[model samples]
Target chain A: MITGMDRLAAAIQGKKSDRIPVFCNLIDQGAKELGMPLKEYYSNGENVAEAQLKMRERFGYDNVWSLFYVGKEAELLGCKELIYAKDGPPNVADFVIKTHDDIHRLEVPDDISAHPAFQETLKCLRILKSEVGGKQAICAYVTASMTLPALLMGMDRWMELFMLGPASVRDELLEKCSDFFRKEITAYRNAGADVCVYANAFGSTDFVPMRLFRELSLPQMEKDLKPVGIDGVVYYCGGARMNAVLEQVIDRLGIGAYYLSPLDNISEGKKIIGNRALTCGVINDIMLIGWTMQEVRDEVRRMLDAGMPGGKFLFGTLVMPYNIPEENIRAMLETAYEYGACVEEATS
Target chain B: MLEDVITAYNEAVFDTDRERALKVIHDAVDRGVSPEDVVFKVVIPAIEQMIKSISESFDANLAQHFMTSQIAAEVTEEMLARFRKAPEVVGHIVIGTAQGDLHSLGKRIVIGCLKSLMIDVTDLGVNVPPEKFVDEAVARNAQVIGISAMMVHTARGENGCIMVRELLRKRGLEDRIKIIVGGAPYRYDLELYKTVGADASADDGITAGRVIAGLIKEVRR
Candidate 1:
């Protein structure tokens, strides 16, 4: 039996595995599996790890995440409060950088692992590593430099400063954000994160102009990834189509993997990526909330048909909705496993 | 002269140059342009055009949208105070994030655009329940309820627009108040608003202003 890690490795190396690897980014859905409050479930790393292991076993996906929530990164930086939802991920209530002066005062803790906000995350990573370290890929999320400030401040304010900038202020904030990003990626790597998802929605043309992406976002991303290196880092744009900049990311950052948005054309993505890096074709999981079983199966088959031809492709989801019916999820995975089987392997 | 002002204002807002945009508006007003004309003819049309011109850079252009909306609201407020007679508001609407969703940026942008378009807006803030959405729309005699949900779970969740739609039906307000939803999720699935029983959905703040205005007309009829 090929391990999940082996399957992903095969896909990454452009070799035919027994079947294509399916990655379910089930974050809040863990609470549903445990019948616990989302807040309580995410408050402790053991609970998150337990849920990840259980969900992986039940759903038979290829990866688990140590990401508590997107807001956890804000909490580590200085956010004082977070709003937890009954059926959604928590959000930062108190933005650390509320004013221009706050940016100057904001500090990236020298040792992020020592920060209280990151302790639970490290614990989750350590446990996932200990239990399924080499067999299953433990994914961790690291917000890229350009997008991290949006977490520190609100997105609206960040946009104002980023687009209509006093260059000094924008650069100052980006410098601090880059420092924090570099440190966070290093910590996640040290704690046994097999894949670091470099999340920067602004990196894609869907969010910014192509010129701005090259001039502003790309330089900061390059700087952030420089010291940490991009060996196992997968460039993600939060589910924004990144095909427009895929070549540039590969050429400049030399990232090993690319998580294409569901909005992106899978065939075009594969053609662009070629064999240079792994291409993950993400399903629009938001639609799963209302899509019929047949719809799910057909969509999964279509994505597999488009992505599986050229090797180095992985089937995945973009933050599985908590309200998605259990049967729908089953249908998606079952279809992936059935249709994603390599032709030669299935015939043999 | 109005055309020059509109052109200057459009270029300033599109550039995300707040200071320049304001200077253009203030200059136009100082030149004896009716406050109403400055708003309806200059600011509103300029913002609509900016949103129309946005193509692949929707997210990146948020800065432009934000500046345009903010400047429009400011100029409208200043102009409203100076109007020879109070300009008639086009319609009234209440807006907020769907329950369990705390995102407010999209809602804020919509409110700014609506205000400049002569639409009266009542913001109920984030994480507002369905009951509040319908109740406030009714109490305020609003023609439409705008729900913003940044996440899939919140956008399609039972407590989101779905519940608000249910509440409207229960209270027999369906004919009176229409529902419109906008957010990242709606952009991903264009027909999600229909699944959630919303009257319509818009892709951004500018389009939202137009959609809600049309819904307001429906309510009036």
Candidate 2:
């Protein structure tokens, strides 16, 4: 039997597979599937690993994640509190870098693998590696240096310092963040994560002006990724449209995969990406909350029609909402599998 | 003279030079420009123009918007103090992040823009509940309630704008106090305002001031 990893590898290498790989980015939804609170489900690697294995088994998707939550990254970097929610993903309750002085004081742990917050994450990765190891692709989330400060000090203050910078302070904070990112990426790769998603919302025009992206965000990201290399790295912009910068990112970063936002046109994205890297077309899962089963099926077909023509494309979803009915998910996956089949007749 | 001040202020703000932007207003004020004229004719229009210029890449220019609104609010505060007589307030609004939603950047941007637009805004802070939104709006006799929700669950969740709308209807205040929502979810789904029981929604904080002003007019009428 063809494994999920095989399909993913085939897609990445621009080779034909049984079907295009489907990545269901159901992070918090895992807790819902396990009949547990998000906090409890995420507190231990066993629970998270179980949830990932079970969800992938149930939905038959192609990828499992090692991401507990985005806020955990902040906790590893001195954020003292995280506000967990019953129905939503957790968020940073208190910014670690509350003031300029706090930025100076913030330190990326010298050995992040020993950090308490990351213990559960490493456990989860080990479990997934033990269970599915070579059969399924394991994704690890890493916030890029340019966007990590938003988690540390909140977006408002980060913007203030970034736009109205006393350059030395902002640069100092970014350097620290970049160092953390390098360590985090290296740690995850060593611990069995096959893919490290380099998430930087500011990389897209949706977050910063083109000039700022080129001058500030790009350079910081380049520095952060230089040590680890970009071979198994996937570039993401936090569900923001990135087609505007797709070519530039490809030219500069030489990243292996691009997770195109729902806002981006699949055809346009494929045209830009060409054979340079794998293109993952993400569905607007927020709309899935209200869309009917038929609507969901239609959207899946539409996306496949646009993205499946090329061999390097993968069908995916953004972080799905907890309220999306099981039937809608069923409809989405069923349609993806039905249309995504790689029979010569279907492909031709 | 006001046009020159507006041009200079726009340039300073576009460059994200807070000090230069403030100096432009201060110099205009020292040159016998009435504070009221400076605000109504110069500051507001400068912000409006800035919004138009950056409309294509609004999210990327958040820093610019944040700085522009902050400068506008500072200038408005100084001018309001120097007004020969109290300027006519355009409207009263209470705004905050919806319950279970702690994202405050959007709400802060909206509050800053509204303040300079002569809207008497009471910030309720983040993670505000339905009862608090209604109670505070009623207590302050505010014309509009603004809820910011960065996530879909909070935007359409039970304790978010939906519950706020439910409370207003239960208390017979729906007609008297209109609701306006701004955040990522609404921007992603334009018609979400109607679904969330809001009178209107805006793409960004600068446009939010105008949207709430319209809602306030509807409430008054």
Write down the C-alpha DockQ for each prediction: 0.45, 0.54
Which pairs clash (backbone N, Cα, C closer than 3 Å) in model 1? A207-B60
Model 1 DockQ class: acceptable
Measured by TM-score, how close is model 2 to the native structure? 0.95
Please write out the lDDT profile of model 1 over residues B165-202, one tens digit for every residue.
Answer: 88888888889999999999998888988999999998
- RMSD (Cα, Å) of model 1: 3.0
The ten-residue window of minimal lDDT in model 2 chain A covers A339-348
lDDT of 1 by residue, A1-348 (tens): 788998988888767688888899999988988999998999899999999999999889899999889988998888889888788888788889988999989888999989998999988888999999999999999899899888888787888788668889999999999999989989898999989999998888777767678888888888998887886899899998899899998999999889999999999998998878888999999889889999999999999989887678899999887888999999999999999887232110
Off by over 4 Å in 1: A165-167, A343-348, B1-8, B23-36, B51-60, B78-83
* TM-scores for every candidate against the unseen true structure: 0.92, 0.95
C-alpha displacement of A55 in model 2, angstroms? 0.9
Model 2 CA lDDT for position B13: 81
- Deviation in Å, model 2, residue B102 alpha carbon: 1.1
